[model samples]
Target: MKRQIITFATLIAVVMGVGFSGCTKLTDFEDTNVNPYASTIPVTQNLLTGALRWLPATVNSDVGAIYAQHIGEVQYTDASRFLGINFAYDDFYRGPLLNLQKIIDFNSNPETAPTVVGGGSNANQLAVARILKAYFFFHITNRWGDVPYSEALQQSDNLTPKFDRQQDIYTDLFKELKEAVDQFDSGAPVEGDIFLNGNPDRWKKFANSLRLIMALRLSKADPATGKVEFMDAKSDGVIMTDAESFRYQHLAETANQNAWYARYLTRFDFAISEPFLDYLKSVNDPRIPALADKPTDGNANYVGMKFGLANTTGIGNNSISYIGSGLREQDSPELIISAAHVLFTLAEGEARGWNAAGTPDQVAAAQYYVEGIRESMKQFGTYDATSFAAYIAQPEVAYTPADAIRKISYQRWIALYLNGYEAWMEWRRTGFPILDPGPSPLSIDGEIPRRQAYTTLERDLNLGNYNAVLQSQGPDEVNTRIWIDKP
Candidate 1:
């Protein structure tokens, strides 16, 4: 198999460049004409493979993990302390989004459609591209709130595209996902789908599962819409088994190995956060050993580092627990979405009175809650019938109708483990299992950040659009809440 290899260094360079540069505009006649040396037509399969390579996954050392308090720095603690705020979304647009756009454009155009059939049937390719585009946009909008959307990727047609409201972006996302699922034809399935092995049925399940998850995000902002979308997606069918979970399997080769594996090769800066470990230990969670490694202090202790400390100079490298070895293997798989996540979402939906049928709301919610935990335990390789039964029998783990949401949220947080960004987003939305900043907090207002600040490139290159978004979305600060994040 020919895999597209994208290194972290290359991604960093792409992100550092100006945003909107992903689109190309021909300013000169020479540029407008295709060069004989270059292939004007893109191979749709290659494009799809390239785009999939850019899909984001949770990495323990990333700041998202720190914000979620999943992992903390054992050495430099700047990220956990919130010293860095501005983040770039350009690499996403430049890499995956651009490739996906090209696939859509090619398959949609009559001239190019026939040529790319080898990759898949025109309708199938377009369906996959649209679904992926929606998924990528969902991630983007969630992080920075209002971002370039409707008029984006216009190449030279519009360099300074206006930022769309997060609400509108989400509305379109739901529509796009639904439409994309409908667009799939009983034709050749997409050939370069590394996530689902080009299975159209699996793709449908993925799209519906994503919609189910996205619908729940509007619980606070738009319950009516949320319930409708959630039920509709549930009716459409979602990932019901662990085998159907959306995962990205990495090869042992350096070109496409796990990012965490690469980081651990020569560095040991990240360790499990004290709060997370302490919580897991307090609840006697069975997944603890599978989640972290015992410290190297010649003892069997699984110590974690205090999150967001100002100075970790005194912390010994061997004193803190590293990420579990099972997770950092070169060929370890990374999850995009899991059955456990879907089960937890179902639990929340039931608790919120969005249950379609089955047992009563509380009863169904409890069933889903327990199953969700089981799925998560199975996912992390910690499931044992006896231990699981004992674990759930505990008073704290037992589900209570009044405290259902809080309980579900805590389990969801644990289930989301390494998926730091999603976990952090859920925390912002639900405020469960409350997280506190370290003693030496540096974020705006000394509170956890609600959103990432716009990158400096946006301010410098797209000043007009940047300023306009700030006016409507509130000041470009870490503390400002996005539209869906209602207080």
Candidate 2:
């Protein structure tokens, strides 16, 4: 009986030991890694779209184009419905500054390669990601002067990244765009490039055009370098060529619908300002009728109000369409930056005296101005082509070199249409075509803000670096000048 008891005890001990060992092994496995309840790739793509979706799509021109010198229609300060939009009326910073935060994040990830996709798998989607990154970054640092760089995209890893000098950032931007453009040299058809329909050659053109913009942004900073880049890239068409433009055609489907169009249905929608309409009228710029469809037509030179103030000012709060006899058009996603603008850049560059390479500044400027004008005349909501042509053919509509630059900036601003902040940025940089500061009691530190205070959220999260930038500039806001911008 004693031996049998001993044997039973030994068996029980072994079984318990085995069970304990198995539990420990399971614990070790659990401690070491993860199953990733979410797929990293899809998660990454969602992150990418999140960044893009944040970019400026016309919310409501009525509120946006207050300083619009191109679409010279509408009159009065809109209620502050477009505070974020008017805050950067030039379309310079907000969209690029905000959305780029995401793009830079995706590009930094080694797992993803960048390319624009029409119908490619996720692996190839990063191309559009890269292109937009460069495009938007160019817009940001150029307007805001010194902005957070090197670590702007390190949201997951580090929150506080210091601002880099605009000069250094521009240098990096040029190099990055050059590198980005070169990546498309694999000339074989890419799987999912949406902007170029998977055409590698077209992607190459976009990269070069982007390079042109980068080069030009440096014009105020380093003219020699800018000229060199301008001349060098002349061999290839600037980004505006039909073969190499970067544009995402909008569709009727809501999934790919325009941002500004959705705003019309919301409480936030407001009318265009008079100041902008007056500017366009002053120049007799033809793009106005196509951009905003006012209910009335009497004030030939009516300009719109500053974006957000109309509601606050109580100007036409109940009026559905405020502009006097302006055309009312359906809303759509206007190009934030265009392919045709690429050619316009070349034209402007030529006018700036860098014309010897291919097209002289004078003629290139004229031709592109005309081409850009024609393209701009295309309707978004509703427009009259004959009226636009009449506006274009007016005696005041001469296409001088200065006029070319003005036209380029104007068209670029109008192309941005409801993308108001960029228009504000261009006005800040080029003093374009010129605009009157609309009714703003708070007037961002006694001046139309050059740069907005970095989001307090960003400051709160990245206090160390954010405070450092503020220390140098003092009170970050619309007054702060971005890197390349020479306000």
| Best by the TM-score measure | 1
Q: Global lDDT of each model?
A: 0.86, 0.53
Q: In model 1, which runs have C-alpha deviations exceeding 4 angstroms?
A: 1-40, 57-61, 356-360
Residue 424 displacement in candidate 1 (angstroms): 0.2
Write candidate 2's Cα lDDT for 1-487 as tens digits: 0111223546766676676685746555553445567443423444444445544443234333443332222233322421341123223233333444444444455554343222243333445556667666665554455666666654334445677877777777767666655554443343423345555566566667767766766666687788888777776656543323344555566676654455444443445555555556677665565545554434443335444343344444443234322222232444545655565566677778775654455876777676655555543322367765676676556576545666677666655555555566566767775654444534555445555445455455557766777776556665556654653
Candidate 2: where is the Cα deviation over 4 Å?
A: 1-27, 31-128, 155-157, 185-196, 239-245, 251-255, 282-286, 296-331, 357-360, 379-393, 401-412, 471-474
**Per-candidate alpha-carbon RMSD to the true structure:** 5.9, 11.2
Candidate 2 deviation (Cα RMSD): 11.2
- Of candidate 1, the 10-residue stretch with the lowest lDDT total is 1-10
Query: For model 1, what is the alpha-carbon lDDT of residue 222?
Result: 91
